[model samples]
Target: MRRKHTLAATAVAGILTVALGTSAAQAEVAADCGPGGPGEFANHTLLVFPGSHQPIYDFVNSAKRSIDLTMYELDDTTMEADLIAAVQRGVDVRVILDGRVGPGSKYYQPGYDKLKAGGVNVVWSNPAYYFTHQKTLTVDDRESLVMTGNLDSYYYNSDRDYALFDANPLDVRAIGQTFDADFADQAVTPSAGSGDLVWSPTTSEDRILDVINGAHRTLLVEQEEMYDTDVINALIAAAQRGVQVKLAIIEECDLYPYLNQLLAAGVQISLNNTSTDTLYSHAKVFVADYGQWDERAEVGSINISNTSLNENRELGVILDAFGPRNQQVLDTLDSVITGDFNDGQTYVATTDPSCG
Candidate 1:
């Protein structure tokens, strides 16, 4: 969607601190965002599909104590059944879905009914805002899966999407707390947890900008679209400071002005022709100073739009240069930046697709 407005800037907060639990061994971050697939299932795993559904099914099926899910869209019947089965097995299942939809509003009714009948607690998000667009899930209150796509089969089966599974107990507690607040339709401060699990209407812009500003050599980004003014400005500053910035995105109107500005400012910008990639360029990822000591990447449901950043509930995880998780995302983003990715003539300003 074309951006409706820009957010007032805020000071970047302190670094997020993760307190790992010693009761269970640390799980390796596993990611399958194409080219190279998911490596292993540890506390932190990133899974990409045509093969993503099985893990989600397994995650939900393995729920022994509780399952908390908040999604923008919910049309996947198989996964819906999995949630139901979890509930049948006595797992406390609760779901919060975005009530807002595009053309066909009744699309989610079937899935909702099935889950409700199967003993899951389902509710719509606070409709006062534009939409509750967060795609996050917590299991047994011990881990979370933050995603850039929906639970719908089409997304998992074909759309280029990314999912991060975090087993850090602190991360899970923060995400679970946010879910609890959203489920109750209450307001949240978005600062309860660390900075690594970036949240919208709060820290996404800062996290994104901080990564850009911290770049010493290079920056690689692949977003569905770019419209946030603060983020765009950070990219421009990075470019002006001689940071090699490369951005890959789908053709959309909301991003036209920013793309023009970035291009004029010497940032290497490219647009993805989704057809060539065999998947919609739907992943939202950022890698700053790739392969360097300060490398950082963020991948999740948050888009670079005002509505996404300020009004909607969105989630993404920041992968610092210290982890293997950063490698998988960096490799994928590098492909988009250096690949024959963008079309120069495909920008048309338009309204939000979800609104239309």
Candidate 2:
């Protein structure tokens, strides 16, 4: 069902309520209105995984009116129960689960059936795209949560993931518009929403390349897959131009060739193996020119692959260091990624069978 009031109206009301009661430390970060800058730096609450479950849970439990969720995978019972409880409390709840996992895959069916039986309005995602890889949740059209990880219980403690809480009205409205269209199985070209959001099958590739090319000093990246030639070339060009590029990635045999190319281009690489590392590198993050005035970080479900960039329904945001809270977010990201890169083993193609 469509919302009774317009998204803008609802957002305005919700924002006022939240602002009146929220503490200064927890206040919503507003977009920088200063002159001579792109309006990409907006309000956001950053959450890093393995320890972000409580914050996410609190966000859901605090919902009083409505909930709109789009997930690529959902097997976390805690979240499932929370959604069901939200529905029971008379809150309007709608969910879109990715349908492209194929017929025999048991990743999402149990949660799907459970949500339906629990009185939540849920449906399979639109199959027009290759996959609905977006992991986002919109609460009361006032706040949007964009995530890089699925809510799968097993990976809750083992994967390195990140999520952003966005309270920008434009972002919330854009997310709501896309949800409404996708809920009914209609086509949509998601809005950039304050020019901060990056959507796949439309502008993800270009936006990511822009981040890569625009970085003048340093680039810290963490990604699960790295097969896109354009992305690889951009990283190589950045490295060739003396940009310090450091990549943290999980070791995948199929990606050896690409890794070799990056290594040959003077890009430092750190490989994480599940057999040896405690945290799997499943995060899609790019911290460009961190700590500088032009510092910005990209975080979401968009992987560095052609399929994820040009085929899947992915969502990401480029967060700039505009406000104190936003700067804190970047600071945390820099610390975590630097540690991951330092702890990982350096990739040597000569020792790998695939590279041979």
Candidate 3:
């Protein structure tokens, strides 16, 4: 039996029940999926991109004591100015920017130079890992913002992304601890942070698969890449077992093979085009059994690729519907995902030899 935690009546009110057929064996498997017990009982706020920049700016602007940030890419001059302003206000600011080089990698030297010149304590990320893909900011050791998008101004208007403001003491402390280690280029293991944080190169694969396998009715996913075989197999298994699995991904020819396999397994797939006029699918998010008792959502910078999951420094959070505010976050996520899926074109497989 799964342990039950008491939730406030306000939190439980209006939670709709969902019914889906599951065999006894599958039910047992779902029951064993951990992270299903009580809620974190922390305050959280969700932010959707291509909507407003105020919330993020507000978080940074309000920091009076200290600011610790880790970013994969930093190209927004406005944000750079904000960090410098914070430093000028006598706030201790530290930043770690990814310095890895590769195709499609954004150059960070200009931003690094600008931040250094402006009196911000900024350093390049540790090169031991393939990349430091974590997009997180901790303010005064009190609140943390975990994000799926970069600070690049070029994608601010077109990228579909999400950020969560977590004010939980445990979550904030854990994030700060990891940032301290990462900023100094030292080895460290990230704390579970109220048992909600998901860190890559460690527990991300197992934790993510647990969420997929634990779903009894539906699973909604949005990702920028979909090349990880374990993730592909997990989604296929969930759909095979009567879970309604839907995925929205950026349209790319290299992903056709994976898309065809998912289509063959009855998983509905939608493709978002890379046009500036449309929302690009760059978010890494998952929603499972929304509106149900075990409803949960995850948002972070972890991508569905071997290097991202196994060798990169990444971070994410699993949010359970435990409080009224948390439920609101999940509700907003579900609505946005539904809209994106509906607005995207249904993918159709092509056998063109040039696709290879």
How many collisions per candidate?
8, 0, 0
Deviation (Å) of 85 in candidate 3: 0.9
Which stretches of candidate 3 lie above 4 Å from their native place? 1-42, 102-107, 274-277
What lDDT does the true structure give each of the candidates?
Answer: 0.68, 0.79, 0.78
Best by lDDT: 2
Model 2: how far residue 195 lies from native, Å: 1.1
Report clash pairs, candidate 1.
27-43, 29-44, 30-45, 30-46, 31-46, 32-38, 270-342, 271-342
Kindly report which residue stretches of model 1 are placed more than 4 angstroms away from their true locations once superposed. 1-40, 50-52, 102-104, 192-194, 274-278, 323-356
**How many clashes show up in model 2?**
0
TM-score of 2: 0.86
Order the numbered candidates by TM-score, best leading. 2, 3, 1
lDDT of 3 by residue, 179-279 (tens): 98888889998998889999988889988998999999999999888888999999999999999999988887778888899988989998886342256
Candidate 2: segments with Cα more than 4 A from true spot = 1-42, 102-104, 354-356
User: Tens digit of lDDT per residue, candidate 2, span 135-231?
Assistant: 9988777788899988887777667787787778888899899899999999999999988999987999999999999999999999888889999
Q: TM-score per candidate, in order?
A: 0.80, 0.86, 0.86
